[model samples]
Target: MTTAAHPLVVRARQLATGLLGPHAERVDQEGVPASHVKALKGSGLLGVNAPTEYGGAAAPPAVARDTAEILAGACCSTWFVLTQHYTPVKLLASTELPVRERLLGPLARGELLSGIAYAHVRAFPRVPVRATPERGGWRFDGTVPWYTGWTLNDVMLLAGVSEAGEVVFAFTEAREQPGLRPTAPMRLAALSAAHTVSLELNGLWLPRDSIVLRTPQTKFAQVDRPRNTNASPAVFGVAYAALDLLEAAPEAKETAGSLRSRLDEARREAYALWDHPVPHERIEERLAWKLRAHDLLRTTTTAALVAGGGRSMALGSRAQRLAREAMFLLVQGQTAEVRQAHLGHLSEIP
Candidate 1:
């Protein structure tokens, strides 16, 4: 893994072990501070997948995933906040839009961090957020149910469905503006430190220049559907952290060894399917991998809690925190199709 890990991934591991892990418990209760964000910026870890010309590593997918595991395992709250930035970077880099020149460099250089308000686009027919064209720009109206990294992000790549059934994606400042209102961050079962919020957009207008990518809603689904079936690297990271806890507790060391062997084999198979040349191919196989990761993540984190005994009940304990995080990951990025498939597939297992 080290040989596959780029210098950026190495830097991520150092930051995670040195800083993020030490203070993860504190931040889990308090919130990911500006200092944590600053460290990410300074370390240049923020641009692992961005273009090298814009001060990024542009590293391979495995390298990116390796860094993801390190950071997410060390401090999921902070990792949650940073993960939002990558989508915008990737989208901008792929497009030749006017906004590309304006924002891609700053984002890739780690000078700017962005969040996503675009998940709502998944509710295709409902259109929680709508985009209508105007003379000056596109006007966005409606509510975004879940927007992560609220105050910490400099900008957000917001998406809305237009009348013509196109997915309208545009950039806007993360701060509250004339038509953008952010609700106070909600306390969650986990990752409350990431500052999650809901946004109301009555008339948020972004100039045409701010527009990044647009495609038919159906086409968007075509591209997005397969992406969610893969196991997230962060799942393994947290599972590994749980395994670490078990390894440290002398009684659970034997169990930890067995789980580690299974976990490694599961990860190898899952990632192989994830890297398949045709993403839409082997759909069932991918979902099976997703379930396996979730199963291991749940099992490992719960085992960690068991190893901690009564002390694990403490709100500040890493065991309890990891358990809560495991709950969050189960539904993270879940789509209706994914949900149905995951659950329906589970019932047939018996």
Candidate 2:
């Protein structure tokens, strides 16, 4: 029997098709105009995963995943910016940190937009950002290699490695504050619309109350490994969009039909493994499906560009945009383990 669609999922799909898709190209060129951010804030998608007690839908995991696919397919740059908020919300909800009560209500109600500055923590062996104990709380020092949603987000969840060897995460304003300075947004190969930058934290300080989560580095990795195995929803969304483009062209219809079947197969297996009851079980199968989905994404996007011919090379073309987005997905969530596995898979090819 077919299940009824979730309301939040339906809302996300509507926003994707009606608002995000039409303006994606322009936003990519101009770097996420303010109007788009305004619309997103009003869309209520920012609170999709927030607790219902905080005026949010508290959507199911599948609802969250499905909305991601819709949003990313419509405008990846927008999707990338908004996606960062979910992690911080998840952290706050699970922790008893004081910030949870103050921020969760506002964040969940879409009163504030959030960004992330914790990816640098994934750089094991080398601590990119450092935290030292101080009077009121902790002092942060070092460079954040990448910080997205610079000008747009109201707050950020920043991370650092502490002297005690624990990973500490805290919340701070997402702008140039007393000890935090952001470089001009980087001109990236793609997703420049997200307005990414490098942040220099000379002696940034946050009160102990700002701290959200603190755990041994080992514990952090234990949690991150399984997450790294799942394929990003954006990959599936973009591949589906490209397939849609291909199907529109008479000569490419058959090619699109074949790729569609493969894409659906990969998507099903990937999501099933992703939504498993156990968080870390079937990890090997998850990675296999992730690689398979990645391959199909590459193939589907490449076919669209090929089908579009010389015109596809133009910056104004959707084919060109999707092609560049596919390239971004290749390394979007790259971890050392993922890179090693992906490379090993490539090396095995005859």
Q: Pick the candidate with the highest lDDT.
A: 1
Please provide, for model 2 over 46-153, each residue's C-alpha lDDT reduced to its tens digit, 9 standing for 90 to 100: 888899898777887778888899989999999999899899888888988799998998888888989999888889769999988789798999999999899899
Q: Which ten residues in a row have the lowest lDDT in candidate 1?
A: 1-10
Badly placed stretches (over 4 Å) of model 1 are: 1-5, 348-350
TM-score of 2: 0.98
Query: Which lDDT tens digits does candidate 1 get at residues 1-350?
Result: 45345688779989998999999999999999999998998888778889998788788888888888999999999999999999899999899988988998999888999999989898878999999999878999999999999889999999999999999899999999899999989988888889999999998888999999989999999888887888988999999999999999999999999999989988999889877999889988888888899889999999999999999999989999999988999999999988988788678865
> Candidate 2 — which residues are off by over 4 angstroms?
1-4
275: Cα error in model 1, Å: 1.5
Q: Candidate 1 clash total? A: 0
**TM of each candidate vs. truth:** 0.97, 0.98
